[model samples]
Target: MAQQLGGRARSLQEGPGEYRLDNGQHILIGAYTESLGLMRKLGVNLEQSLLRQPLRLRYPDHEGLSLPPGPPLLSFVRGILSYKTWHLSARLQLLARATVWLLQGFRCKPELSVAQLCAGLPSIVRQELMDPLCVAALNTPSSQASAEVFLRVLHDALFSGRGSADLLLPRRDLSELLAEPAQQWLRVRGTQIFLGTRVHTLKQAADAWHLEISGAPQGETQCFDQVVLACTSLQAAKLAEPWAPAWAQAAQALHFEPIVTVYLRAPGSALPAAMVALNEGPDAPAQFAFDLGALGHAPGLFAFVISGASDWVAQGLKETGAATLQQALQAFNWRCSPEVYRVLAEKRATFACTPGLQRPGIQVARGLWAAGDYIAGPYPATLEGAVRAGKNAALACLQV
Candidate 1:
C-alpha cells in the first residue's frame, strides 16, 4: 500500500549491499501462503529462489524425523511408524496425543505453556522434536512458549494442506531473495524510498502525521494523510506514546527474546542434509545448524542458530561462538577444522511469545496503523506474520 499510496519507505541502511552483511538465517514452510503470494507478486521465482523438500529434521548423527510426501495425515502416521529412533510405544503415545489435539480442534488454554501441553510425551520426542520445533517456530523455549500458538502453528503446517509441511530453504542472501525484489517492485510502482534515513520524531496534527527526519541537513519534516509504523515495537512505542498511550503501553510492556547466529567456515565440509537439528545444552548453544553449501552458498560455510538465546547472549558473542565451534567439531565429521567466521546476535530478535502475552494491535489510532511481526497475531515473530500484518494494515488503511 505504501507503494501505491505515494508515500516513502525509510531505512537506516543504504541498501542490502551496504548493510545486512550477515543476517540471521530464516526458513519458510508451504503453510506461509501469504508470504509466498507476496513473493510471487514481487517477481521472485519460487522454484529457483527456494529449495522445496519434504519435512525432514536430521540430526548430526543422521537420526531424526522425515515425513514423506503424501496425504498429510497418512504421511504423518507413516513417518511416525517408520521412526526407529523412538520405541513403538512412544510413537503410539505421540499419535494418541496428536489425535486428541486434532479432535479438540487444536485449541488449548491461553495460559498453558507448550511444556505443560506435551508433558506426557516421551523424552526422546521432547528432546529431538518438540523442544527444537518450539524454539524454531516461536523463538521461545517450550517451558515458556504459548501452547495455543504452537498448536495452531502445528495445525496449519501439518493438517492445513498436502504440501504445507514442506520446507522452503532460501538459496541466496535475504536481500537477493526477497528485499531487493520488493524494493524494485515498489520503485517500479512509483513508491519513493529514503535509504539511510531515520524518522526521529512523529507528531500528529489533526488527522495527519508529521514526521521529523533524523540526520537531515536542514531539519526536514514531512506530512502524510495516513501513516503505518512499520518499525520495531520499542520504536513504535516511543512514537505513539504521546497520542496512542494505550497502544504504546501495550507495545512497551512486550518483552523480547534473543537469537544468535554463529557462522563457521570449514572448506570441503558439509552436512547430511541442508539443515540439521543440534542437541542444545550447556556446551552446545546452537539448536539448529544450516549447511550453506547445500543451500547454494559458499561451500563449507555453515550457520549455527541459537534461538531463545538469553544465556548465550550474556556469555558474550566470542565465547558463545567458540563454544558453538567446538560443539560443531564434535557433532559433525569435518574435512578440515572449522573456525568461527562471525557471530551475529539480535538481542531483541522477537517478542517473547509467552502464554497470554498481550500484544499491541494494528490500529494505533485513527488513520494510523502498525505493521510488524510483533503486532497481535496468531503466529509468532516470523516472516509470514510480518507479511500478513503488512497486507492487513494496508487493507485497513484503504478501508479508512
Candidate 2:
C-alpha cells in the first residue's frame, strides 16, 4: 500500500489501530479489503450513478437509456398501490399521511415552478415516494429535499442497480453498517481517521489551518495539507469564528433535529424477528424496531428506532422508550419492556428541515471547506448528503 501511494503514505501511520467504539465494545483492526472484494463480487456498482450523468433527467421530457419507460412507471404505480393498503406498519402509515398532506398543500397553492415541474415530468415519474418521516430524519423534509437532490436520488434508486441493492439489504445497526464502511474506505484510500479525538477548535495560519483537539492543554495544533471541516453546522460555525465571523454567523443559523433509538433485550421467545414497522394505531414514540440478533447481535435484543423526534426530547428516556415498547408489545404480543435494556438518544443527530435554511457552499472561507450531513445539498441531513458534501469539499480543496 505504501509503495503504491509513494511518499504520500509516509506521514500516515502504517496498519490500523484497535479502538473501543460506541457501547464499549472493542473493534479489532483488520484490512476490510475483503469487504471491498465482496462488494466487487456482488457487482453492486456502488458508485454514485447520478455523478456520472448530472443532467440526464433534469429536463422534463428527457428519458434515458436505462429503464423501459412503461416498466419503471408500472413499478412506481405498484409501489403506490402497495402503500395504499392499511396493513402498512404504523411508521409507513404516518409517513403516507404526511406525504399526502404535503403533496396536497403543494398541489393546491401550486407555485409556478413546482407546478411546471409537476406538469412537465413524465406521468410515470409523477407520483414520488415522498416519505417525510425519513426526510426529516436526515435534516430536511421531503418537500425541501430540492428538485436536483430528489432527481439524483430517484435516478440512482430506480435506474442504476446500486439503489435497489441498498434497499434490499437495509442493515439493522446503522453506525456499524454506514460509518464502518466509510472508515474502511478512507483507510484503504490512504486517508487517516483519528476517532475518539474530538476536535475542539481550528485556527488558520499563513498557509494552512491548525486543528486543536480535546485532551490537550494550552493548545496542540497540527497543520494539515488541506483541511476539511466534516462536522455539524454548529462545529463549523465555531471553527470559523476566529477567521471568518460572518461565515460563522451564517452557519450558526442552521438548526438540527434529534434522533433516538431504544434497544430491547427481549427473549427470542418474545418475538420471532428483530425488526418490524407498524403503520396504524396510537402515536407511538418509535416507528420501527430491528431484531438486532437476526442482523448479527445477541438474540435477545431488538432495536427500536425514532427519527426527527423533536416532541420527545424533554420526556424522560424511561418514560418515552417504555411507552414505545408497551405499544409494540401490545400489538405483537412481544413480551418486552424498556426496563430490560438500554435507550440511546442522539439529541443533535441531524439538522432540521425548513425552507431556505442557510446552507453555505463548500468553500465558505478560503482554504476551509465544509462537509458533513449539514453542508448545502438537495437532501437535508442524510449519510448520502454527507458523502456528497465530503466529495464536494474534496473537489473544492483540489481546485484550490
Q: Which ten residues in a row are the worst by lDDT in model 2?
A: 1-10
Q: How does each model score on TM-score?
A: 0.94, 0.64
Off by over 4 Å in 2: 1-72, 81-193, 214-219, 270-275, 280-283, 335-339
- Model 1 lDDT per residue over 229-345, tens place: 988899899989998999999999999999989989888988888999999999999999998889885677898999999999998999999999999989999999999988888
Q: Give the TM-score comparing model 2 with the true structure, all chains together.
A: 0.64
Q: Against the true structure, whose TM-score is highest? A: 1
Candidates' RMSD to native: 3.7, 11.1
Model 2 residue 41 lDDT score: 40
Off by over 4 Å in 1: 1-21, 215-219
Model 1 Cα shift for residue 126 (angstroms) = 0.7
